[model samples]
Target: MKIARIETFLVPPRWLFVRVETDAGVVGWGEATCEGRSETVRTAVDQLAELLIGQDPLRIEDHWQVMTKGSFYRGGPILGSAVAGLDQALWDIAGRHFGAPVHQLLGGPVRERIRVYGWVGGDEPDEVAEAIAAQVEAGLTAVKMNASGRMSANGSAAELDGVVRRVAAAREVLGPERDVAVDFHGRFTLATARRAASLLADLHPFFLEEPVVPENSHLIGRIAESTAIPIATGERLYSRQEFLPVLQAGIAVAQPDLSHAGGITEVRKIAALAETFDVQLAPHCPLGPIALAACLQVGFATPNHLIQEQSIGIHYNRGADVLDYVVDTRPLAFVDGSIERLTGPGLGIEVDEAAVRDADRRGHAWRGPIWRHDDGSFAEW
Candidate 1:
């Protein structure tokens, strides 16, 4: 079947969804969410659609190469994210056409179920406690939180203590059996990340995410070597070539966003690359259902997969939640701290077309917060 129409929708609370329809009466859905930059990625998707309008829908890899490398200026967040959504839609169409799940197409099931974690707010000690408890109540065995709100370039003693204290509170609630991940969010300098890593090493967090920003990736190997905490990053990274340096940096885990890192096709290859480094894969997904579903599909097939991140009840979902646009929520149901294998075809979840259309009519222009330090210099958020 040939690709007939490609449509993009700007939904509520910082998400962009793309739909690909084939002439043979089959439709596929994918999430091209760039969080703060959905509008730009929407335009990128439209531009990329020009190459895919009449091509065969099942030629996923060929189309991905062209969409990604067709232009000289390629492989940034805009183009990678645009290609990612279309790639997901193409995979979904292939799965549906072949009457199999995407993971089965990759290879047969390697595991029976996938473990998942939720994002918890970590600004305050009480917030961390309550958030972890709520996730525990929701049957999530693991949860991730920010290391600090907007940190100074050189973290003060108070800043360092507060980070440790908030994590300590989460550790108290989660106990020993559960896991908690600390995200630096690229707010810390190399010295600051190194110091935080030394202080928090005893708590044994699931991982320290983006201890230093992507631009300073040359320093990550030093951070990884100094502390035993698993270093995870790559939400901002978009391709396997970009991930190579980080992988060689002796990181313990690689957290590539399926939406931002070239979707399934590229992330699957990334998983393989990380596998060679003996690192685990925990995809960075804090968007909507389609993105989470795509992550789960990869998790089920990937052997070195560590855990999954989902955005159900995450603080960002103000007006709409993860399950709002899905026809069946059973596939995404969290049980016993893990999601069972999705047996349905394609991405294993049905998109609610009507809900999506309605939400698009009242489109949102959501943006991530911009932070400035007390000195008025820009700070990472």
Candidate 2:
């Protein structure tokens, strides 16, 4: 069937959803949320609609190539994210048309259930022991927390101790049985990250996320070599080319966001590239239902998949939670710290069109926090 219409919704809680309708009464949904840049991605999607209308909905790969490479100035967050949502919608349509889940189309199930990690604490951690306990009580076996709020170019010993203390608290609650990961959020410089990594060595963290910013990703391999803890990054990276250097840097995990990194088509290729380097995949998904569902589909199919990150009760979902716009939450239900392989067609979750439309009418202009150090210089947040 041919694509009849493509619509985008800027829903609450910093998410952008795409709805693609085919002429033969089939519809597909995808998420194109770029966190703080929803409107820009929406514009990019509108531009892509010029090429998408009347095309075969099942030609996912072809559409992806054109949407991504059709323009000379391509492959940034805007275009990549726009192409990402459309690609997800096209994949959803293909799955529905073929009567199988997206993972099956990729190659069939490699795992029975995907282990997922929950987020504990906020941008700046507090009462982390209690937060870890609460997540464990809620049936999560692994949880991740921010390492520090906004760090200085060169952090003080007290700040370093606080970072270690928070991780220590989480480890104490999780004990030796469960897993705890820390996210630096690209707030640390290379020197600072190296020092922090040295300090965190004793805790045996599952991974250290974005220890340095994407711009300074070349230094990641050094950090990885200095510490035994697995290094994970790529939430800001949008293509396979951007991920190549990091993978070669001996990064233990590649955390490409299915929503930001060219959706399923590109991320599948990214997974393959990481496989050559023996790097594991843990998709970065802290958005809404559509993004999380897309992540699960990839996780089920990918062989080297490590774990999935979901936004069930994440700090960002203040106004609307992950399950708010979904008709069925059963597929997303986390049991025993893992999500069972989805048997349903497409992305394996239904989008509540009514709720989406209602929320779009009262659209949100959400933005991520901007921080400044005491000296008035910009700080990463």
Off by over 4 Å in 2: 122-125
Q: Report the lDDT of model 1 for residue 311.
A: 91
Q: Show how many residue pairs clash in every candidate, following the order shown.
A: 0, 0
Give lDDT tens digits, candidate 1, residues 18-91: 99999998899999999889999999999999999999999899998898889888778888899899999999
TM-score of every model?
0.99, 0.99
Which 10-residue span in candidate 1 carries the lowest summed lDDT? 121-130
How do the residues 69-173 of candidate 2 rate in per-residue lDDT, one tens digit apiece?
A: 898887788888998999999999999999999999999999989999998873545778888898899888999999998798899998898899999989989
Go through the candidates in order and give the C-alpha RMSD of each one to the true structure.
0.7, 0.8
